[model samples]
Target chain A: MTQLAADIASTFTAEGAEPFTVDATLEAGDEETLVILGPSGSGKTLLLETVAGFHGHDGTVTVNGTDIADRAPERRDFGFVFQDYALFPHMTVRDNVRYGAQYCENPRDAEGLLAELGVAHLADRTPPTLSGGEKQRVALARALAVRPDVLLLDEPLAALDVPTRQSLRDDLVDVLADVTSIYVTHNRTTARAIADRIIVMAQGQVVQRGTPDAVFERPESPIVANFTGSNVIELASTPAVRSLLDGDTPGRGDAHGNGTAERVAIRPEAVRLDDDNGDLRATVRRVVREDATHRVTLAFDEVTVESFTDSPPEVGTDVVITLPRDRLHPC
Target chain B: MATETGSGLDVKTGRVQTAVLVAGFVGVQLLAFVAAYATGRPTWYAYFMIGSAAVTAYLLDGSSFVVATATLGSVLLIALGLPLFMFVARQTPSLVVEKAADPDVHRVLYLGIYGPLLAAILSLAFGVPLAHLLSEGFSGQPLVESLVDLPLVVPHSVAGILVLFGFGEGGAFPSISVLGSMVGMVLAMAFVAAPYAVNATREAFEAIDHRLEYASRIHGANRWETFRRVTGPLAVRGMITGGVLAWARAVSEFGAVAVVAYSVSFFYPFAGGEVTAQHAPVFVYNTYLQGGLQESGAVAFLLLAVSAMIFLIVRYLTDDNTIGGVP
Candidate 1:
């Protein structure tokens, strides 16, 4: 299996504006989906386009050890699905699929691919007449028809309803099962669902990169922890959370040798409610129902902690809660 | 049941009223024509025709404002068209047919048609690429725009002087005999009309999405291939429409062509002594000056007919809604 590697440094200069510089290195293994997660203006799309040979960069990009820095976009054989789908408005669905296939040395069956993408009925319809989801399906089918070496998707499901996004996300996993792909998105839920590995970007640089569980559970940086939505509590400010760093707590103290870390994060689900055997007692400030679970915001001295449980205690009720030592992550 | 019958009778009465109105209109037109003929004033006949057309249009449409505007426009057209039509009508059929078949007339007509067509083609070839660059935020686009607009804003005769100074003998290229040549006539016409082609093509290119071209490049097409397949087809309609307008303007141009090339005969060395290379409008003006109204009117009438035919054919081919059939 071949790997696609890129080490890029580029600058974007608009007239009468300050130049923005982007520097990052990325790698995607064969049959792996690597999701680039970032906020808007973080240069995620710029990085993808640069890797696809659509823009000039200072460093090198190679596939299977061959440098493709100077190659044209077509010669690079990278399939890009733009944010708006960018299907040729003048051509029918079948024609658009065939348009890409005609450029390939050994093309896939375009009609069969469209059928697999669940857009076979739309083969004769033009792009403007189709719904958003249908356009996305046709666009994906067209990109796949070329049998490209690397597939680049820029927010492929960003413009869709919740149900449609979920369905298509599932479909994408199945369709891209054997293809090397790089997906750029700002939505964390989408990143979690689509990525076998996640690269979190901030201000045009890669802040962190690891498996979704490792990054989400044990973020190495504050930006990563904040982006992953983990509950970050300052150990020096919150006495109740500070207790986890003490040697009295069983498994948590071993991970942090001297308890020198200032802040720690605990997953909301890891904060549990207990009656008799608990480390801390706090007053419930608010309770809200979320799907099948209850979210209780507990106020203890200067700190507020959120815990998920089967049934939430009423506001103003005093309860005993415990933060499992092993679940506490030092940041 | 009573209401339905009343409505049916109302519809029948409406039809009768329309029939009477149309009959009255025809009767009035006949009377006007007879009165103008009795007076022996063909101009009066033109006024009557224009007045009848306006009144009939108003009666059917029930809009006085529109009718008044239409009447004003029709009067202007009739003022120019009537004398030519009457002069053509007065000539013996054989004499008019003989004039049409004359080799001198054929030479002038050919130069008038083909020169402008060549100018339009040249404008498209150069203007399209410039328009594309300008649409992409070229820094000097405004300067180019203002330069193109110079010919349009200046008087046609001044435009002729400018072309002469730029291209004529004793000018920038002193050895070239551009004056009284076909090249001079083409240059003058193109200078006055190229703005239309540039502006229209620029707007068409701007209206296209840049992502369409980017997608084409990603689909394994080179830059030229992408333009040939995507950009060219999409912008062709606007280019054709602009070319037609430029050609029409060039064909009717007189002041500039007259100042630069009073006659195109310099380029036609083999033409007989009687033959001349006068543009259509220039030929008409010369005839009116030398041979009175009848001869000039016949030539003007022929030019108008040819211009009208070209306009209709181009308009039909470049109909907005049907171009490329995407919409």
Candidate 2:
């Protein structure tokens, strides 16, 4: 068992709230990034905040195997980054970082940390005057400045533009390299890129948990499959997408990479466009140029298949497409 | 740096336009002034009329109308000023506000929370008379009747008498005898004036944000430290306003002080032993009823001048925008 910073069990309930219950054990060795993906009102935030000790809910949250059941937020030794960055508007960049250092026994390394975060020059600039990217960096720096045992991020990049989000996403991967973090996001792209292990939550429960590939390729529930943009098809004989065979341990019990997948995941880009007569053929329904590539939807007798191709057959043309045997997964 | 093109009117043309507008406004005022003079109307009335007209036109038409009206108004003022100057040169000095106007300094002070500080200070100065009146009681027995007619409901003279008896001979106030002393008067004034401070300070404290206090607390500041650093700075304005109001209320008090103490001599009532049950207002009133009208008017004018100065000072100190924004 890996050493986990925070362990959550039991149900958490507030006044007029439906009880939220989740039992999950995360050990330290799961250096594997855990992504909590869910829709709005799915209690993903509530779960994260509960672990951070902000929510007054029933639950046993143990950090480093020690129960912090009644501990206050400041004493939880967890760094939380809120969606809006929650940077104190009155404090400058330096003070924001220094705010957490007060909890530390000795803050001699505060200046060095600020310089490391690349915000030393902007130490005196307030949150309001800093750019969106700068504010995000300062907020992250403030959270990490505490060197918390568990880092909880609540949709950190949801407020930025796409380009900034992408750049910051890369920055976050590097910054959070050694930190035990719980990343919460609604964006599938974010979860796919950064999360080593993804947990799909619906309503108030974790529906699936595994590496990004395992969860994305073989989503146990429709909600998880749809959320990850996977084409969830119901079929007999063979699964349309990749799947792990029965009695197979996932990647020989290693959940991170090369996990044994029960269902096939033929990425949209994997399906090739074949004009020459092929085994799988269908009439073209619609072709759309999305971003740099074209998404061609082909209509078969019982199912509509989607493929991304550089060249698109005309709308009414009968086009041939193929899902390789290896890519075909069985549930 | 967005400059207003102003309907594309030529800049050079605006100068000519402004001059014409001023000339027209002035021409009309000049005509009104000349008409007033030719018609044998009181010359001072011309200044008032022209000034009112210019003010009205300026308010309604902005700068253009103001310039026009002021051109005519200035000439009218000059004409009126010369006559006013000659009149002042010949007339004797008198109270700006008269008894006919019923200019009660105490009443205004109470109504606006204005002159309490001045009243308190005067109470201190006239403490001897204050104590004398309280010990001797009222000879004319007018204190009771005057208390009803006084500006505020509290009989200031009665308040003075209480201070004297409490702090004077045969007094409950053993070591203190404001009974014919400045100390007693100050106590009485403070008693009356302190409420304004208490009320204003309370209000000032209420206006501060509790969040700022919370932030200070979370930052590890104790209650007193939080109050000193955040609450105190925030409430300073209200505190000052309250203090000024209280001081003004204290200084302007008269009836209570007059009833409790009277001057030894009527001529120099301000002298320690001179102020008595027959205080400045009583003397001023008596002069009006017994002495000639000149003496009464002079005293009334002196009171008016002093009260007006106090009122202006209080108004300036307690103006709006006194509190700074917290966050």
Candidate 3:
């Protein structure tokens, strides 16, 4: 059953500025974590806020078969965590967690939730004094204290440093295991790690929705493929690269590679760099040092592909790049 | 090479800068003592003030930018403080005590302090609601704000005349005459002082993150409840600070009170009122007109001491328990 269903359409209006409208329809199953993945200004936050009833919208929102479209945010039963952890600075951590519990009939104990999120020792401190990771943990505990019908988070981990973000994300996986949640972020790694189902949005519209693997591995649009960190090559512009995907993943294109698909995508991990005997002869364009490996950009004719290698060739050097047929997915 | 790292200097440079700043602070105190305690040879001390400020600015940090900024700040501080400190420092304790004992001075001081206190209370009653409305925002916000801020730039005498035109017997309200009453004095003071209350409270409300309010709301706090428990508590300090500032502005006011109510009769016959005692600023003006600079200065010192004491006490009470923003 759908735990929360939202059909929201809101125009973000700023004085003396052009308005941007976010129109989206989505649902999360009971005990499932549905994630909204998008870059900045893609309306992911706007869509989430409108669904939470912070902004006036033109569509209906229901939770567990109850229509809450006309209800104010105060009357709604959704718990929202802002991107910057909007914990009241005047209140102690324990008070903040107990805040939501004041309105609920059967609320989880604030101290127990604090201990559950590993922030019990920080319960007496204010939000400004806590570290980034500690503040986020306290925010999570506060949101869950009310046992909300659906928890809506707007990139709660984005403000932390890299190490803090990674550590908190690991904790988030366990915390969000069974909570019906709607999380939003631009980080593909986090979405893949935390989401039971994911939707990709761009320019205020949902571009794709599916299980994480289905969306990342078989993106049906070039925008989705590019945003998910896959290199997209137009099959028509580089006709020679078509034959390389002879036995690739299922494509909308026919056997001759002349069909409805305008582009094909391949993950950088799948693109192989061979010194010789590769299917496509290419030249190394650039090599950037990444953690544990080097990302080498190879170009053959007009088609450029990125490949990860342990020992990368020098830039402007001749190299043979192999595109595995099974790895190229049509978009 | 001398690199400009904006306070992030190398170890040796950082240590030298710190030493120079500490020495400069001590030099400023020495200069203050010379100007205040030893008032003779004013010319020599004036030259020293200029020279020390320039040298200290250049020596505090290697960067010329600091040299310019520190010098500018020092000059401004000296300009504002010179007249005030000179007047206070020059007065003898016996004469100030003599001025306070005068019955005429006592009635005016009481009127001066209590009149502005009432005006501040009146401003808060009306100005806070307007500030809250302004903070929520609407179209033509700037226009409304301009009207709220009109009194700030209006000439004091014109503000006085405008108050007379609005509140006098034949003006807007003929039934209630405020030509020479305490109400008339309070109205004129609030006319000029209400803007400080409104703007300060508005800024405080705006400083609170909207998301915090939303968090309160989603946590089941209704509109009034959210404001009462969250928004109202956070903005209380700002409101009180504004009220104190409004009080200060009202207490120092002279032109408007002179036109609206030169001498209050509500507290008359209660005190030794031969012709009805006036507010402090008006009394000071009257003393200057009747007597000379010497008598006026003595009474001015009395008002100054009491005003400063009250302001500092209020400020200490409402100091910073600021609502922290998530950094």
- TM-score-best of 1 and 3: 3
TM-score of each: 0.76, 0.54, 0.87
Position B57, candidate 3: lDDT = 69
Candidates ranked by TM-score: 3, 1, 2
Model 1: per-residue Cα lDDT at residue A168 = 92
How large is the interface RMSD of candidate 1? 1.9
B1-327, model 2: which lDDT tens digit per residue? Answer: 125465355676788898897797667755665566557664654565567666756675769757676768667666756464433332344333454344343333222222234444443334322332332234653663253224345566666666666667788768765554445544666656654555566566666554344434333345565555556666656666666666666545666555554432222322333322333454566667885666566555555556668767767765654433223
- Predicted structure 1: clash tally: 0
Q: Put down candidate 1 lDDT per residue, A194-304, tens digits, no spaces.
A: 898989899889998999888888876678887887777776787766664575532334455654567777778888899869988889999999889998898886778
Show model 2 residue runs off by greater than 4 Å.
A1-32, A108-111, A234-266, A276-279, A325-331, B1-327
lDDT (Cα, 0-100) at A306 in candidate 2: 77
Q: Model 1 chain A, poorest ten-residue lDDT window?
A: A247-256
Clash number for every model?
Answer: 0, 60, 1
Q: Give the number of the best model, judged by lDDT.
A: 3
TM-score of 3: 0.87
Q: Of the pair 2 and 3, which is ahead by DockQ?
A: 3
At residue A45, give the lDDT of candidate 3. Answer: 93
Pairs in steric clash, model 3: A248-A325
**Per-residue lDDT over B1-327 for candidate 1, one digit per residue giving the tens place of the 0 to 100 score:** 999999999999999998998798768855775677667876687767787778767877869888888788888877776655555556666655666877777677777787888778877888788777777776676788899778788999999999998998778888777888877888888988888888888888888887777777777878787788777777787788778878888998889999998887534434634345788889889888997877776666667777889889888888966567224
Q: Rate the local accuracy (lDDT) of all candidates.
A: 0.82, 0.61, 0.85
